[model samples]
Target: MKTIAAVMAASAFLAACGSDEADDETTTPDATDETSEETSDDSTDESTGDTIDYPDLSGETIDVASDWSGAEQANFEAVLDYFEEQTGASVTYQSLGNNVATALGTQIEGGGAPDIALVPQPGLVDQLVDSGDIVPVTENVVAQVDANYAETWRDLSTYDGELYGVWFKAANKSTMWYNVGVYDDAGAEIPETWDDFMSTLQLVSDSGVPGLVVGADVGWPLTDWFENVYLRTAGADMYDQLAAHEIPWTDESVVEALEILGDLWGDETLVLPGGAQRSFPDSVTAAFTDPPEAGTVFEGDFVAGNIADQTDAVVGEDANFYPFPSINGSEPAVMGAGNVAIAFNDDEATMALMEYLASPDAANIWIELGGFTSPNQNADTSLYPDEVSLAIAEQLTSAETFRFDMSDLTPSAFGGTEGAGMWSILIDFYQNTDDVEGTAQALEDAAVAAYGE
Candidate 1:
């Protein structure tokens, strides 16, 4: 797929802030007559609009709650520092550090909510929406974002037709990360159909290397597989229905996808049984640490960062990616993962920063730091500066259809329920292939119980 390139240039200076004592300011937006409709950039000016000028905020601290760990977290802090220098709005980051959803919920309940929170998971966004604790980007704000990012991200970040968050660093998960050397040795081409894909796997296995490695221990990874299969097997509409809680799990299309996965699980030549014990973080090890072990892994682009320390396999050079093949020439399924900005204050300066952050400038900053695909349409992909990341960014830009993580978009509870159900399905298929129908029924029953439909 051809991607629209991002216009990358040297970082430009933004306006500065001038305040010091800014503290816990968690007042909801005045719910009086809030009007939200998609507006173009012409209607919303970055130079002059309803945005407030940079306030004099030198030491004034705004709490930013997050769950970023390792290099990603460090990079995030650097970005925050950029914002701080420009706005003079010093950030006292309250690292949620781990278990973001739980920690943020605790702070919200305890009445010590941060002014800015980083919601990395969609389930948390759903919860915040349900609680009315989140505020949408004001009309002026949405216009600013719309001018910068692709409309698709705005649609995804918006809940119930209201823009609630600013999206950043999105990576398309409908990708298959493969071992190039292994493929070269096996003399294989990337598959484009289910039969072709199966044949490739068989060919790889025939060469005595595991054809694939998937991590199910994290639960969400399993959802990734399910979403990819659902999109390929049942098509996008059905996948959306499943996402919106409008489709029953027992739907024949869903069952057929599950059955195919079951068959794959039964094929011992396909993947190592060790994959069942690996989590998302451990998937890199299980899949592509070295040859003679595992060959390919189905995961998101972020997996690149995880394996960087283990292998010198650069993105486009040593490693390559392809979208998960469709079952029967259906359109591809694209999944996204990233953080959304949720605000707790409505001050003019705060709102201005929020609006600006949603603009093309912020997108540039994100891409420069090797941030994932920005939903920002104005963002120049070259900011990624790396060939491989740039390729992934282009993949995101050209994607015809996109959805958030399968588990995170679903009700929080179902991630555990349906995820465990799928695991059982895999185990069942491994033990007794004839039990596919029974396991499918079990999954449907479990889904019905989870959603009460």
Candidate 2:
């Protein structure tokens, strides 16, 4: 199969989908179609022995909200069209862009929230629930979620033991992309362990080629590095604690994570020049252009789209990836993000569409459409556009555990806060890797203040 270049057209639509968690034990009853006979939900979703029971809501319409536009919006519009065809509900989508959080908040404040919303982060779901919003989902939707996705996903969408949303799309962040020609010239195999990866880095540096390119211009990539290191050293539980502000950023685990990072990045010469200033897309473009400046870029799957859409590099031939190496004796822990669909006001029509989305049947539709990865376990994997996508799906599913982006989990104030929170602190850390302790303490002070502890 050809690489996913064509399919990954509108990449970066869900850049922040990684940060956020839901609605009800709804016990809402399933409604049968008017025909009272099962039919395939959509062309791509059809299977030999399976059928979908779509509810009939001929004249009812519901408003959907998201931050998608351009190609991303088109992809979703296609899915929404398919949904309308299946259920006969007129669903209108509103692209709220980056201000979805604010836009939806304003709507709720004015008692005009959309019937459903595709929340980029689980934190938005929490914000809605905490404000006494009582959106509900049918039990069937919950069952579909449990049967089709991993427990971790269910947890991400759950609020205080009740489920709230459906994981519709995801970006696996536990991979690093490199130039195959560069690797071939260096005579290096993709590293499978932390030690081996480090040695490979040294070899690249020895070859006079930079070892890695971190898109630290925005500070989030630095946060990704910490998350990967912490997941490897301290495992997932500690990762959770740090995200929830239950543990100070100066905790021993945080230090260990920072140390591990320092070991990998302390040598400024190993990184591409101007990484602190270059945008993520700029870094990717550099790697694919002639006489690449760096050997590899550590980023999520979305980087594939950036490469394909922006450069002439052939994915899998010129641009490719390997799972980020295991570290500190921990197994593979995937760090990533996804889009979650939540209801603003549950109704027969809203609950019906949600239940449909929760199922593997609905997920497979998007999977076959390309540029979409479903966490749904039962979704047929054979339909992925290419080996690149299929392999990513496999690695993501087979991971020992999956954690949302760490910075995305922390309050925006602490994680993305400009000049004061993790963002500025990590930028400083990048500039001066020797002051690991001071950096860790700075993070702690920032977290304490942000969390109001």
Candidates' TM-scores?
0.77, 0.77
Worst 10 residues of 1 by lDDT: 6-15
Scored against the true structure, residue 424 in model 1 reaches a CA lDDT of: 48
lDDT tens digits, residue span 370-408, model 1: 535565555544446477676676565456665556555
- Against the hidden true structure, what lDDT does model 1 obtain? 0.61
Query: Can you tell me which runs of candidate 1 are displaced by over 4 Å?
Result: 1-54, 92-100, 120-126, 138-140, 159-162, 290-292, 347-353, 416-435
lDDT at residue 307 of model 1 (Cα atoms): 59
- Go through the candidates in order and give each one's C-alpha lDDT: 0.61, 0.70
Residues 156-179, model 2: lDDT tens digits: 666666778888878798888888
lDDT of 2 at 108: 86
